[model samples]
Target chain A: MISFFKKDFLVHWRDRKEIIISLISPLVIIAVIGIALPGWVENPTKTLQIKVALVNADDEQAAMQEFRDSLAARSLPDDELLDIEQQLEQLSPIRMLKQVFQAEHVKEIVSMEELGNDDALQQLQEERIAAVVTIPDGFTLAALNKMVWNDGEGTALRIIAEKASLQVGVLNDIIDGYVQKLNVQSAFHHLLGADAGAAAIASDDYSGIGGREMVDGVETVTSFQYYALAISIVFALLLSVTMASKAITEKRERTFQRILLTGSQPFHYLMGKMSAAFCLSILQLSIIILISHFALNIFPGRSLLFWLGVSAVLVLLSLCVGALVVLFTALVFRLHDETANGIAFIFSLIAGTIGGSFVPIYILPDWLRSAGEWTPNGLSLAVLLQWIQTETVADLSVPLVKLAVFAIATIGLASWCFPRRGRI
Target chain B: MLEAMELRKVFKGRTAVDDVSLFLDQGESVGLLGPNGAGKSTTISMISSLLTPNSGDVRLNGVSIVSKPQFIRQVLGVVPQEIALYEELSAYENLKFFGSIYRLKGKQLEAKIQELLEMVGLRDRQKELIKTYSGGMKRRINIAAALLHDPQIVIMDEPTVGIDPQSRNHILETVRLLNREKGTTVLYTSHYMEEVEQLCSRVYIMDHGRIIASGTTEELRRILSGEDTLLLKLDKPNKDLANVLRSLAPIRHVEETDNGLKLIIAKHSSLLSQIVQTAESHQVEIINIHVHTPSLEDVFLHLTGRTLRD
Candidate 1:
């Protein structure tokens, strides 16, 4: 087994092009993307300024104020007054919408400019603004009627942006949050009636809803920190494929058979290939991490313990990637080299996307985000990112266990697929 | 001793080895001769334990090794038809790796590698990468790799295919030494009849997945004992004269040639004088006349009616 591993190690070392490509490709990708992505993701307010038109088109503001004054003049009972006040708060959709945009994260993401309908639409087309938010006329009155009387009428807000623009999605997310909050309020009013709803609303806690925790006292995460680890996972997978390709070449050259005939078992050959991949992955991961830590300064400025935790997670991830490629190669052992290449490339893309190697997990749909966290790559990055945020290794146990299970399952599958006494 | 009894292997409903049985004494050299796709490789693969026979079993010494292949595998050395050594590694490295697999290490492994390299006549070039070596040189290293462990039996499957004559001769000489000096059993397989004829004490001829014949070279040649082949080198071509000679009663078969005519007749037939006289009468001068001995090639043609290379 040692002999098999040594042969594979020495062979890969002799291939200067493979070694160079494995080490250099990740840095190049990270550098290109790190330089190309807008700096807004790193420091939203200090970087590129995206403009949003916040149009207040509600013409019923005067009427709603007059209604509130009339209710006060009618000398209503104390409990009735309190119920009306609670209902008024629930009916303030425009206020709720304005507050969501005013939040720190969104405020940093886009600068709002109040504009008329025509000017906002014109600005959006001219690319002066990323999106336009139009509060329709009678929006306040409609919202009030829906909440106070359980009216079935619906109100709509208009948003205009270029198709598939990132800012449009961000704006939609904020609006969705407001709509969810309104639904919760409406449900409570229908369940308890105005008097009981007022009591329930007063006692209900709203502090935790849509709340953001500052990691290391900073609300923003740098894009470099993301790709620093994301690209490392991607490149680690590609390097493992390169190792698998070398294994295939050895099979084609008949050296694999030679080793087997020398009394090395099939799993011994697998161990050799796995060890080579694991060793290279560690080297690749170490170099990429160290560069990100020291040169790029993308890693959290934490002590050695923090980086050690991060490294431990990455090591497991690297092993999983290596084992994954081994299984992939074994499954496609009879294919042509080109087909093998195509499979590897397509697998990398899919695993990267599903594992959050190309995009941050938090930005994905909830189900997909959950799925990404379970994947070896995403879990590794999650652990790293978590360690960076908490500056501790407390949240690493689950991911480490997951990574171990993934590695074992893949290695077992690969071993089972490997031919025991024949050419593979 | 290694014994294979009634071994059969069917691949996807097509039989590759059919009820084949072979045995090797501790020190005897055995050869398997056949054309391409003739089941020689399949037979060796079964004996090497790299492949399992669908039926029957192979035994080393006394025990069947089908379930416990490593027992025989440990004592066996196989050099496949392909150049199976790592091309990117030096000959020394390749030998060391194989030696390690056989559980040899330290100075002992180094000494054995040196000895095997010397045996294959590649000691001075052991440090060069195999990729840098000539085809013949690579073949020598390939043979050297198999001998590193000094196994009880060495199985070489067409080891000299596609190499220069020098390397082929070197490999033959190495096998001769292993069999003659060290008394190591060998099972040599090849399509090259001359290689088997030169090295094998006993030979097995296979065609279409079954052994056609097995014997010493002389014993196999005796299959054609009753016939004598006569070759006449003519000074000039004469189809009419050849036809006239063919009408003689003793002649069994006559085949035209570029420079001569080959005649097959009864072993005891004394028709050479009659044929020469007949040729001279037609003004067809016989420049030289020679008798042809039956070779393994003739035996193969007699059995399969196809050349070994075909």
Candidate 2:
């Protein structure tokens, strides 16, 4: 077994063309894609700057006074009226809308300018701004009345744009989410009681609505990191085909028959090819990552524990590649044709395509993306991306187990497909 | 001793070997002689346990190896017709790997590799990659790889095909030394009759997936002893002269050669004058005429009615 392994390793190592192709091809692709399509991999909104005209017609103080007068007219108890006033002060719809727009993340992508209704419309028509957001008169009073009494028709925030664009779509979603939250808070108040509703409105969770919170200091994945890992995995998958191609040569040359005559077991021969692919995959991935990190800082300032996690993932991914090599080798011997390499190549290409190696998982259709996550490379890329961000050891468990299962299942299938004694 | 009993092999509805049976005694050098499509290689494959016969069993020392191939694999070394070696690796590396697979290791493997390389006359070029070597050099190394384990039996299938004379002579000499000095049983197969005649004490003549004849070289020669081979070199083409010779009573078979006509005739028959008279009557000049005892080539031609190369 060791002899077979050593021979396979030496054969691959000595083939300068194959080695160069395995290592250099991925690095070139990663560099090119990373430089060419950073925004696609990174935050899509980073390159989009949406300009909006804000028309604030409702006066906050007047709306509050009107709400108080209406409450007094109803002859409600002073304590309940005071509590309602307090809730109104904290949950002013106009003020909250302003805060949502003023959020740092929101401000990064959207620029809002206050203008009169006429001027805002004019700007929108001229395409100087992406859209016009209008807070109609009596909005706050109407909103409060709807929340407390559920008697009056609710006021709606209106947005006018010349055409439906990404900016307008983003603006619409943001406002829609905000209004839904407000309505939810009102429902909670009515269902649970005054104190519960006020508490929900006073939580201030809505203040950071525009930005995502950092959980446990997890960082965002950059384009460099994504392509670095993705392309490396794609190339590593090709290594299995490369190893199988060598097996084809061995069979064509009758070296495999010679080995059999020496009393070497077929299992040992397959394991030798698998071990070679495993080692080469690890080396190929490590080199790609190291160079990418040094040249572009793909994984900057990652902890030792983080690297250890990465190593664990790398090892499992390599094993999966090794198992694929076995399958390809078995196919080569069974089919006794060069088409085995082509079959392995097509398999790798499909896996890479569906596994998010060529594109981000978010862009794929929901079904394909889900399937992609199960692919070894796709799963590894996702896990590595998560590891880069979350650094959570627990997140590694399911993917690691899945990868191991994939490896074992593939090896079992390959063993079954392998040619039996005298068949070769 | 190794024996292949009534072996038959079919490939995709075509029979490659049919009821072929042969054997090798310990320390004996035997040759399987045939044309290109003969079942010699297939027979060797079955005996070496590389292939299983469809309806036969190969035995080693009275033990059936069909169900237990490992029995023969442990002591068998097969030098396939193709250069069955890693071209990207050096000769020494290839030998080391083959030796290691057979359980030789460390200094023992290294020494065995060195010994085989030297024996194949490739010691000085052992470090060079097999791909860099010439065809003959590669073949030499291929033979060396088979001997790395120092097995009790070595099966060579057309090992000297497509090589220069020097390499061919070297490979034959190596086989002779292994058989004579080391007492290694040999099962050699080739289409070249001279190679078999020079190296093998016994020979099996096969054709069309069956063994037509088998015996000592002298005994096989005796199959043609009842007749003699006549070589008549003609200066120019004459279908008439060949036809006339074929019609003669003493001549049993007449075959056209590149430069002449070969005739098989009854032993001690005096038909040369009649052939000369016939050729003169046809106005065909006889460049040379000679009569000799039948060799293996003549024997094959006599049996198959075709030359070995044909």
Candidate 3:
């Protein structure tokens, strides 16, 4: 084992490192973009997110008193009420929305870092806040009073920004409009003396019945994550292809062949190559981890399940890829001339692309995304990115199965086609 | 002992080697002779278990290598025709690696590497990368690498193909010494007749993919003992002039040369004037003419029609 490592390390140092830098492109890109932008990886969305503190002024009890409330106090809701009774009404959905402030967008997101200590609303200038909703503490009382007395100040929501970025304006406007409509509807119901009207709106019969309910009726359907997934898989594939070619070169250079002739079985030789590839892949994975964690800080806010899930899937995927590369590269050296190796390189590139290395599957045409999503690189990236963001394993099984199928196919390809005596 | 019995190999749609049989007794040295693409390397590959023959079998001692190639490779040392060793690695490292392959390690591996290095006269230069060495030096290390495991039967495929004469001679000498002192069986293959002539007691001559002739060196040479070879030096030896000289029956073969034509004849008197008269008719100038006894060149000419090298 020591000898194997020594030879592997020497080969890496003496030939590979000198011929080309190790994972230099990833390192450089991660560093340059990471340091220069400091947010590309962290903020996959290129635009600055609008960050505003929710200024609530409901005349409801304090948050501490609210936290103490127990739904258990209610008699187990009668089964009939559970189905159609005015129902156990829930807390109001907050006014969660974004507005494009154009020039003020960047300030809106970054300036909140100092907002906690302000003695005044001095920074509450129109340009300083992209959009503001001053929910007066009497908002709930006013609505109740207007409903009960049929006369009072109805709550108002307004925008403060002079300019609006398109999507931000639209999404934020939609969310704000939703909050207003819900308030009005609830106020209207209270006029009839029915306190549970909020439930009626939530269980809307005429909304986007295509899927799950959305906040403010805005659903975030996307293909962006698919593209990012491709990026990760493509890099891993690049590593695998090089490793496979390097295996043959390592053997021909008389590094491991000599060992094999000394009584080590053919299996031992194969194992050694496998071991080297494993170590290299794992090391590359670590570098990526470091670059992502510290350099980009992409995962700081990510849940532990998300991080674990992504790392686990990627590492295993890389391992199988490395193994397949080794077997094929050795086969190339032994039988076909150098041209086969060239062709393999092209295959790797093509696989990466079709697998969604460059094109994220989401934006791809529906048919293409479906095809790409099932591809090894494409699927692996898709699942991993989803895992990282959602921290859930809901759709991971398909990618895992696809990965296993790919590995098995590659192994069979190598075992059947690789020539035994090509090098000797 | 290493024996290759009626070995045949085919690739795709073509036969590479056909029914070739040969042997090297313990400590004995034999050579396979052929031009380029004569399947010499292929035969070596099969013998070393680097290849599987389509028909026939290779035996290390009396055991068939086809069924159990692992053990066969253990006792066989192979120095390929091309420089198979890594150029980036030092000669010493190459030897140690090959030594370890044969399961020689600790002091034994070191001593073995040192001894082989000394034998090849490359001990002082062993620490240098193989690429740093000259062609001859690389060739020497290549041969030494084969010896690291101290295999009972050592095989070389055109071992001295691209080496300086001095190193070539050193390799030849080393093979002789290993055979004499250690009783190592050697299967040497080469295109150069003289190298085979000097190192091998028996020679197998092959053309295309089949061995056409096989016997002791003397026995093979004796086939053309009745003939004599003549050197007819000419200022301008043209093909037309060669054709004219070739018209003489007793003159068997005529190869054009810058200075003259080298001819092989059955008898001296019957063809000398015919050759001179023919040269005059073609306006060809004869530089010098000398007659000598038959050598491997004549044996090849007699057998292949084209000179051994064409």
Which 10-residue window in model 2 chain B sums to the lowest lDDT? Answer: B41-50
Off by over 4 Å in 3: A1-9, A17-22, A29-233, A247-263, A288-314, A330-343, A365-380, A387-424, B281-283
Candidate 2 ranges beyond 4 A from true positions: A43-218, B237-256, B265-284
The whole-model lDDT of each prediction reads 0.79, 0.88, 0.64
Residue-wise lDDT of candidate 2 within B1-310, one digit each (tens)? 8888999999999999999988899999999999998888788888888788899899899999989988888888889999998989999888888888889879988888888888999999999999999999999998998888788999999999999999999999999999999999999989898999999999999999999999998998999989988888999888878888888888999988899898999998988788888989998889998887778988898889888888
Tens-place lDDT digits, model 1, residues A124-178: 8998888888898877777766666566575778888866566576667667666
DockQ, candidate 3, comes to: 0.18
User: lDDT tens string, model 1, B24-116?
Assistant: 999999999999999998899888877789999999988888888778877888887778877779999989988898789899999999998
Interface RMSDs of the predictions, in order, are: 2.0, 0.9, 3.8
TM-score of chain B of 1: 0.89
Error of 1 at A328 (Å): 6.7
Clashing residue pairs for model 1: none
Supply candidate 1's per-residue lDDT for A308. Answer: 78
lDDT for position A415 in model 1: 76
Candidate 3's residue-wise lDDT over B219-274, tens digit each?
Answer: 99898877778888777748888776678777777777667778777754576676
What is the CA-based DockQ of model 1?
A: 0.39
TM-score of each model, paired residue for residue: 0.76, 0.76, 0.68
